[model samples]
Target chain A: MNAPILWIAVPFLVGGGILFLLRERYAAWLGGGTAALLALIALVIPIDTALLLGPVSLKIAPSIQILGRSFELNTADGPLLAIIYGLAALWLFGTEASGTANRFVSLGLMIVALLTASIAVEPFLYAALLLEMAAMLVVPMLVPPDQKAGRGVVRFLIYQTFAMPFILFSGWMLAGVEASPGDLGTTIQAGVMLSLGFAFLFAIFPLYNWVPLLMEEASPYATGFLLWALPTFTTIFALDFLDRYTWLRTTPQLTNAIRFAGVFMVASGGIFASLQRHIGRILGYAAITEAGLLLLIIGLGSSEIINLTFLILIPRGLELVVWALAIAIIKGRIQSLRFADVQGLARSYPVAVSSLILAHLAMSGFPLLAGFPSRFALWQQIAEGSLALSFWVFLGMFGLLIAAIRTLAVFVMAKEDAKWEWNESWVQTIMLGLGVIGLFILGLFPQALQPFLSNLAPLFEHLGQ
Target chain B: MVTDTVSWIAVGLALITSTAILISRDWRVSLGALAVQYLAAFWLVTRHLPLAMGSVKLIAGWMVIATLGMTRLSLMNLEQQEEDAFFPRGQWFRIALMGIVVLVAAGSAPRIEAAIPGLGLPIIAGSLLLIGGGVAHLGITSDLLRVILGLLTMLAGFEILYAAVESAILVTGLLAAVNLGLGILGSYLLIAGSSPLENEDEL
Candidate 1:
């Protein structure tokens, strides 16, 4: 296999093998090593070139067919793969960073692999299987046998499993049409199914609790994988569907509907996040709300919006990593993440608190921070699209910003409790340092990213128009 | 015409099974009902394949696997004694009534006309039963595993509908693997020597 393909596939193959061999302990190390290697390869090698291995020729293109349907892996997929592999590496390393076992790493690798495959598989129905497989992998990682698996893992799986049929049906609906996304009937069915699948996959509205509940019950690292990988993949996959369905781009009504859904998700997510007492739950809400914003950007069906959407995912993905680590720190120290429980934590470890604040700020789209530029660009798109709708969207954006500010006030600025002592580890300091640098790098020099962002412009324009 | 009748019967059976899962309090019956639903789904799918020896072999092999899997699951259940609490009879009756309405509506949908001839009504009814049972399970159950099982049943129904539309064997096989993997994972979490339920009260 070519290096990029290997980067995607080897982790699952090796890590799964290790899981069976070493069962749990060495599986983490093996999986982690594979992930690190994959991340390295992702950074070094572009996703190009077909691999000729024995009888099989593995191709990398805009799309590929596995059994009967076609799946595309395009130039636009570079950043997404990078993010998945990068997160996989971080998650693997995270297992060792804490004293947790390796199951999470193994499962993480498996899910990432499945996600990569989902992006490349032809005839999109295979993506449904990949998604369900991702859920299956998540179950063992989330709840250990010694502890009763929370209803949340099952619930998460249930929700995820439900998305497949819709995706499959949609793909099948597309089968009779010409392969291009230009066919109107095929495009319409594909768009609707993709929308329904995404709505279910993302767990919007009545189905939304799984994210929070899973975060509440799962290991922080597993939660990181769930937030970072699954939704990220699903969002990209949804975008890919949009890419394939020309009808979605042609239908102004569809785009408008999507935009409305996005704003609604952001508003509802922010409102819920602000209401949540548990820090992890708060993170969950914030993540989902951010997802809403990204989707809203996607809904605009504009090159400017899509480019910003991709840009935002990078910083946001990293910010989630930092936030998850921050929660892990809090959990490690105090064993609870409730507001009252983490009260006065700032006085003891200013480094951790500062890092948390940066993460929170990035999440909120604070001015001169990682999230600000993309959020600003996104707003421009919204405002230009429709003033009336833009007014409401801006209001929702501010609401989220206020939620972030409140989290900062409550968690980072609060007086330290007299009883709690700080560990003040160098690891915490290093993580904090990275978070600061990351925020500044993306925030101050948005133009520095223009070359990379512009390179992706064509794909978005293709998708948007 | 014969295939069409068989498809409808299978669909009706699935709808009945879904109702059985919804109203019946016993987990055992639900499992039985779910297995039957899967078999019905499997039967409906078999009718979709091209009428050739290869397709017949493929269908037969899957049926055998289904039968074996069901047998194993049944035996495992027989080994466990705790009974699940039943839903109220009124709720079951209401759900059944609603299911019938959904069945009729799906049967009457304009899309039904375009469906692959033998697969239409069964696929539609099976899908309704599946989604209805799943929603009902989620609405009614507090127990985590049972709810998951209900969701699985729901997925099974949806898969049947999709398979009827297009039997991309690889995708279907992958889906089966996922289902089997999920079941194994769930079972491992629930019954593998140590159960999360052991300390349920403490939690």
Candidate 2:
């Protein structure tokens, strides 16, 4: 395997191996710090492949054999891997300060490894196993002992598992087609299964309870990571599927369904989050909404949509950082996240509160934040003589905006019973300040990142077409 | 047609057993029902052994669930045992209902004209059984462990189905790591006691 791949796996292996070897404090810091460095290194490395075992080489474009099937990575995979691993590393950093940091780092890296394999492993069956594994890997992060294992963790596991058959069956259908000569019958079977499989895996619509259920019991930090990374990786993986089978992209009805699902998820998530009392669950719902929006972009089948997804993803990372840090600072002492509890909080911790507001605005797709540009372009595309889609997209955006507004009301406008005080460290202030600046920079100078998004565009474009 | 006949029978039996466990009023009967379902799964894998190393995995997962269930049953104090929970009829009905829905849904999917080589009807039915089990798990069990079992069953179902396609050794090896993580997580949850039951709505 390539050094970069090793870089990702090392922390997980070492973390798990030494989880009980060292003192808890040192183990967590070591694991988290290692993961962070690995991520930084991954971002700098040019995507390359190397031999690991025989013909099963790790390369930018090399064949991989999984479950008796062959798969290869094209040049496009480099950026996807970089983004997935890079974000994962950053999420690991938050783990350093939390209770399950060791397990989180271990599982986080393993997930990254599995996701990478999902991209490179062929025959769809390999990807199926990898995806299932990713879901299982999260069990450690989500279900820690001492907390009664509520129905949420199991629900999440069941939902993901139930979705697995669709992928497996679809892979079988695809393989059968490959074996036979021009079998349209098998292709259609594969197509239907593919759609259903993805729907289940992504937790679209009715199967979506696992998110809220799991969040009900899990750490906000872990939930935040799960919300952002799992769905984002799955979205990218789904794009890979469309890229592999060009005809899927041409089917406007399918695209329309994806768009519709996206709109529904965002709208529903927004409404749900607005009513939620817990801050963590609010973030989870927002992520679901964000995921729905990305799907809509994919359904649009434009290269620019891929660019839009990337832009959306990067800034969302900042939200996780801000939320995780804030939660850690608060230490779960606050009773409720209702606007009422958050009242007078800002007076005490202006920097943290301001960071929270900016993050919320960015997440809401408000103007002058990182989310604004992408949301603007995406909405513009939706509104182009397609009022039905435009309406749904607009509604989805509006739902998120409402959720953000509600959060703002709770923290900014609600009255408090106690006098406010500020006591967070300077390091936290610096982090939040940088996060706000990052959002502004991205929003004000979208052109600066245009080249980066454009360079990565062809990878998706080629596969999609 | 031969493969289909075997698969349908296997799937049918598995589904029935799954529903039995789901609807069973007694915890002991539910455990018994689960055992039968798992045995059927093992049988399903044997029917397509060349394609399915999944049976070994299925057995391993079932063993874990069975041990945990036994432990919980043994550990439950008399007063707790007398309590209505860990065996709620309402929840059991939900499990049965979900199982039925899964069965109908899986059965209703358009069938493949021919079974792929090395992947016969038994494996297909076995896979469906696993999915149904998952549905039952999520629906019937409110306890964390039971739900985890449901999820495990669901993954087992996915694995059996996956066997009918490409047999990627590396993927299987990688999935082992995932399974290990599941084990670790389950242990952790058992260690982490539950919070005071809350009626609070999740965000």
Q: Using TM-score, give the best candidate's number.
A: 1
Give a tens-digit lDDT track for model 1, residues A110-201.
77888888777766557777887887787777776566667677678777877877777776676655366566666666668767877788
lDDT per residue for candidate 1 within B1-203, as digits (tens), equals 88778878887887778777776666567666766776776776665544442243334334433543454464454334334333444674657665664656476544654543555655666666677667767666655456656766666666666666665666666765766665566456545324234553222
**CA lDDT for candidate 1:** 0.67
Q: Model 2: per-residue lDDT, tens digit, B47-144?
A: 54553565555556566556556555644553254245676446656665765767565674436315344566567656766676666567656665
Error of 1 at A354 (Å): 2.1
TM-score of each: 0.84, 0.83
> lDDT by residue for model 2 over A335-396, one digit each (tens)?
65545566656666677667776777777888888888888888777787488877766676
Which DockQ values do the candidates obtain, in the order shown? 0.43, 0.43
